[model samples]
Target: MIVYSNTISGFNHDVDQGIIAEKVHNELNQKGFYNSINEIRSWENSLFYMKNVLYSPSINQDLNIAIEYNIPNTSKRVDFLISGYTYTENPIVLIIELKQWEKAERTSREDIVTTYLGGSNRAVTHPSYQAYSYAKTISNFNSYIGDNNIEIKPSAYLHNYKEEYRSELENDLYTPIIKKAPIFLKKDTIKLREFISSNVKKSDQGKLLYEIDHGKIRPSKALQDAISSMLSGNDEFYMIDEQKVVFSTVKTLVEKAIINEEKYTILVEGGPGTGKSVVAINLLAEFRHKIVNYVTKNSAPRSVYFDILRKDKYSLNYIKNLFKGSGSYFNSSKNEYDLLIVDEAHRLNEKSGLFANMGENQIKEIINASKVSVFFIDEDQIVTTKDFGSINEIKKQAKELGSMIFYGEDYNLTSQFRCNGSDGYLAFLDDLLQIRDTANYDGFDGDYDIKLYTSPTEMKEDLKKLNEINNKSRIVSGYTFDWVSKSNNDIDVFDIELKDDFKAKWNFSNTQTWAIDKDSFDQVGCIHTSQGLEFDYVGVIIGKDLVYRDNKVITDYTKRAKTDQSLKGIKKNNNFVLADKIIRNTYRTLMTRGQKGCYIYCEDENLSKYIEFRLNKVLKKNN
Candidate 1:
């Protein structure tokens, strides 16, 4: 007899016959990867755990199982099997009805176990529970007699099935006793729950079930062990727990690369605070390797090497001679390091493709440049609003390229180490990315180190105060009228006020005071002047042009990028939607750079409200 396995294959088509309840289920089915029951369970568990993992790592739910006693004169046995890990002294983890294919409904609507599944058992007599019990019994009977058998129907033996097991559970007389049982232990119980609750899915059902039963399922012990090892000891540098190490999986993998000292290619994926950049730094330090070539989309070209310079830690002059290009200039020994670490690799897009404008994949260049290649891929961190920046495509590229090479693999850093020590932002981020992620915001304080000030006068006062603390380090700048060096005029006011005095106030005329000019502030530039760059403190000036027009949706990104105009025969155009997306992304990047603080100036109330809403939501809920 065929047992209906949860791991259904080739079942992506809509099966209106109670396959799944709604459009959401259909959407999940179409994703192709959600083929197995285990996968479905994992998706739900991950979403649930994501809500509390960071904020309440110790939180746990106690599962209970109880069976009703039935008493009468006859010594009859009505067996109802309780599945899951049966405990000797503890409550049953899961109670399941054992029904043969001969019967359709296993339990009646009055069965107490129906309400005990996902909901609490406190209200067993609730209307919902009663309905479930009755419906289940009927369903169980139908399943056994003739479910999906077309011609056969249950009307044939309807009387014989219902009368037999009716008294076993309904009355309060039959005493329960354990017959045979496995060793009941706490760790094993937790492990069992975690195992059965694993999210990984397999295409085949029989094999999957067997695998689960035999303990061959899950995130391998190796991965968990690695996470456990790193998290065992608390770090003096950072206040964190064992679970926090999951967030640094990327760091661990990179450190492994350094120790192995062998040619390897790795793709690390995660949301913010996953420690991609910091891990890169530590990896380079551990290997004593010189950084020859560096590429980034959102990081400031100058600040790309900020950590090393700030600490005077290591020399990476070898990069000067590795390649020849507009920004290629480094000095170091021959073959200084055979490792290439690309930060924000998701930003490497089609426009940035290598092959000297031949449209060859640029990532291939990085892979070929070093014996070992490491990429920090975060599609959520695409700040430049460029078309080519996507981590999803990068994974595909890596797989396709790896097929041509000898070895290639990818890993996801599970925990979010940055964006504060909490997981709220990570939860929201998962939802934003449309992944089934759940997280809690308990005890989270939604406050940022940076403050948003729309008033220019208030901004100036704040910047002055911030600068007083560390003028050389803290930068105060805004977009300028003429930051676009290629433009014919110094400034193009597409939509804002402040154009009349933006550059002059920043003393742009004197190159030493402003970093935008090659001849001037080689280290510091105003916000507009520092496009594509970041700093310790970025004070953004949202000029008056930012307004919510009645029909204008600044989020509509229909314009060709500054780099894309050459490919398509179209001049640069500013669609509000695209502009809004770019602006938001830019702000996110800018705000995140400050190790300490950030400030924003936008007179527009709607835009301010939006910014405050997002920022506050992340900060307050993510603790």
Candidate 2:
């Protein structure tokens, strides 16, 4: 997928004649690729300088050159790649990251530099570190790199920076990365050419580039071992009988579609804790040979999964390609992926971009991107207005696209695996919350622990005790509290205030692994952070947004926090019923996150009494 590839002699000729940028742009346009005018301008500037550096008499003109080489199964592309051989005839590739930054400032974090980008001063990866990571990702994922015993050399060339700014780019914090992949500034053009010439002494006539582009891709042995070790002895990875049935059915469908070269959309519908994520991960691990990816809209579960799978540094570089956000397929090629297992499909956004003006429907894009698209959805989990991933909508889109949709008992997971396999508990919850009617409205017979708390402090104390035993318990709340800074220096201020001096901070935004971080137990996670995740025990704080009024659950959109983006403008909408439904759905999803037990603290006294009445008098009467 290289946008431009040719012999070094040909590239030099094109660049020397000042037509290289136009040639690359014409090729990209012909391929239906999207690139902004600003990006093309940067490419022209960088390539013009690159031509000067590679035009040295010592550099071999017959070497292979490629620009904008697309990384397989990913949205990223390398800036430039040169393939040749050293004097010993060993294959070598020089991965160059070209930057046009005239100035950059060191950030508080290592390997991160701040520069003016996208109309604002933003933190971006240091060029050298970026190049090194790109090279490492290729080495870890590309089978050809290992099979051919190729040597990869990564470097960054900042052609617009002055010599005095070199100190900032070569800071002590970035010493290790710079040692591995040196940074070349405008003054270091001669040195950069010398480094390039030193590595590539002979030309391979572009054979190496062709092999890399056309090589068979498989998970590296190290990656396979890492995944196996992560899944081994993990009880959560084990699937139940119903789960196994669904897994077998979906796998067979995917295989059949691939064999027949046909398109199929398999929808797996289940409520919370029906093992959707468990089945999705198992499918991902088993279907390594096929071009499969796990897609989700929420970052919390995806980040937690990545953290759990790639505990070591070696696996982290390659694991990211396996997981993608739902929006990543907006401009993807048709039928590019063999299988796309979309987890938490209910969270898929309608559109992407900062203003949500870019791209068309994500559902259509996902369906168009893959031959066999398997979507695991929970209709009740549509917590936001933008989420349009209903089973009906998916079916409609699939029909419009001329793809067959398969959903029935074979696709529905009935057996509950969470809350200690307490199906009655879920039924009782549905009835008590008035989200829907259930047979267990009056009583629930289950071993799962459920309790209502009079105070938030008591619920926190109980959660602490539970966490001490298993370390898989935390307090989560409705988005009712405003996250405000108490002092200029303290950003993680106590946001959730309660009586008896009980106060806690909202979960840290930077802690993507909040569910697993031991220190995060004290912070209260909102719905966005807790969705698609499970814990041994959960403490839920029902906020003022929901109340029990006139024997029916009522929703007050005004009670929701101003900081909560999901609930924004719901109060202004004319559809009160829809708003209430979304609010109830949010609470239901929160309460069901606990695998074995759930403790509750409600802000509304009337709601608390109603919950108790259902657990006690109503249940006893029904019995």
Candidate 3:
């Protein structure tokens, strides 16, 4: 597909927008390294270990070089250079051809689809394929030289050269595997590699896959870790022993009820690792809320929001305009909303304004915005950040809103169910990082809510083991917060294909076909797609970039940013806090997505430390 660089208006051209044009040009010019002929030559020379005979003047090499360097012979500057030789002294040793790299302009629709799907649309061709084609062409180029050298007419030699080049091209480009020796072979070596390289320049599968895993291919700092964790299968949630359930069983059940609930001003008190943002989105879907506005304490959370908007079938631009009151994308009788949900509500306090003079506190504005308001809070997660909303403060706001009191359901989902259910690590986290808290379940004797595993490889192995226990009943899958780097007609390339099979497997038989780079209905899974939807099991990927050193303990973004008073300091720490919030929110979302249990993959060493620290505290208290 033709990817148009950001455009400049006619006015810009008339007014000498040279600087802007230069900027645009620079950005567009930044294609992959192998997209040019100059790059191929540079790369070939850099290989440093090729056979010297190929470059030497051994078998009629002079004639071959002369043909390539000849003037006025520009027949599309033939990329394929083939030479064959039967030296009287060397005994017809070799035949060689070469293929030169060219910045290929995408020529077909299929090219766009594959690149977009595979998430490498930015890269013109897979590096491996490019290398192989170049080698094949090079080999074929050498086949043109034979012993009859002087006796053979120029026409016959030229015909041989063309045939050799064409033969190699056909085999390398169309065959599944290279039958003849193709000096280079491209093979996938990592996860998702096979899927990405399945098709050739026929499709933009790389970019598409990148979008599917993350919202955009190159995510901002806000979602860097989350996206990485998700793609790598590093985020998950587990159950603590009877004593602690951070995303405890009770909390999960309660969340399910709230999502299923049609009426009421619901309040959720989620512990750390209990997915509050995920629950909010699910609840929005269940209730069919007209406007689902999500606000979080960090840039990561905002990135999460973007992921959901872009991945889901809902038109993001339409949704964005809904807030503007200018578009006709959606219509509703009520001016306010059917329901209002706030995640990380603890991060919003008396100083934050929600609406016109509703109150400085966010809770007040939330209550005013809808008939039924759902506030998901965690006082501990707030961690002394400025404008931190306390549970007590929320209770007061609820009273002022005149909403009937609903029993607060606390989450104990602290099973540390990731890293192969490592309880030791979980216990370590609770003891080291969290503020001490008690639960009534502590009195009972039972399994440690936390678990431990050797490493990520073991974690995946354990998942296979768990799946074996009950394959149909317990579906083990993952969630990612990846980014989409390319777009087709303003639609995300990743969310375009809503797999009929994936939907059917998930029991969404009625789900419509959603285009990967176009707005479609089945985008919600993790942060990229799961904006206004829910799932039975959700896996979250939390990374270390989200954590910052604060008093030897990892702190959330709200605590770091809002608590800092100096404007300069806040700006300086903006990235740090934003990173923290996104990671934290990712955990919150994953924890809540599960109606039964959540899985986690946390590659960030710091996140693992934090999880271990929390689990340790829970274990110590139980002991």
Off by over 4 Å in 1: 1-263, 289-337, 349-359, 385-387, 403-410, 413-447, 471-538, 543-580, 609-623
Tell me the tens digit of each residue's lDDT in model 3 across 515-548: 1112221233333233222332334334332443
Native-to-model Cα distance after best TM-score fit, residue 286 in candidate 1, in Å: 1.6
The lDDT values for all models are 0.35, 0.79, 0.33
lDDT of 3 at 472: 12
Off by over 4 Å in 2: 1-238, 312-314, 486-492, 618-623
Instruction: Give a tens-digit lDDT track for model 2, residues 12-91.
Output: 89988888888889876554354678988998899999999998789998889999976543335789999999989999
Per-model TM-score, in order, reads 0.44, 0.61, 0.31
Better of 2 and 3 by TM-score: 2
Q: Whose lDDT is higher: candidate 1's or candidate 2's?
A: 2
Would you list the rank order by lDDT, best first? 2, 1, 3
User: Model 1, range 147-243, lDDT digits (tens) per residue?
Assistant: 2221110100111123344333223321121111111121233432343233111122233223222321111011111221222332212212211
- Window of ten residues with lowest summed lDDT in model 2: 219-228
lDDT at residue 383 of model 2 (Cα atoms): 85
Q: What order do you get sorting by TM-score, best first?
A: 2, 1, 3
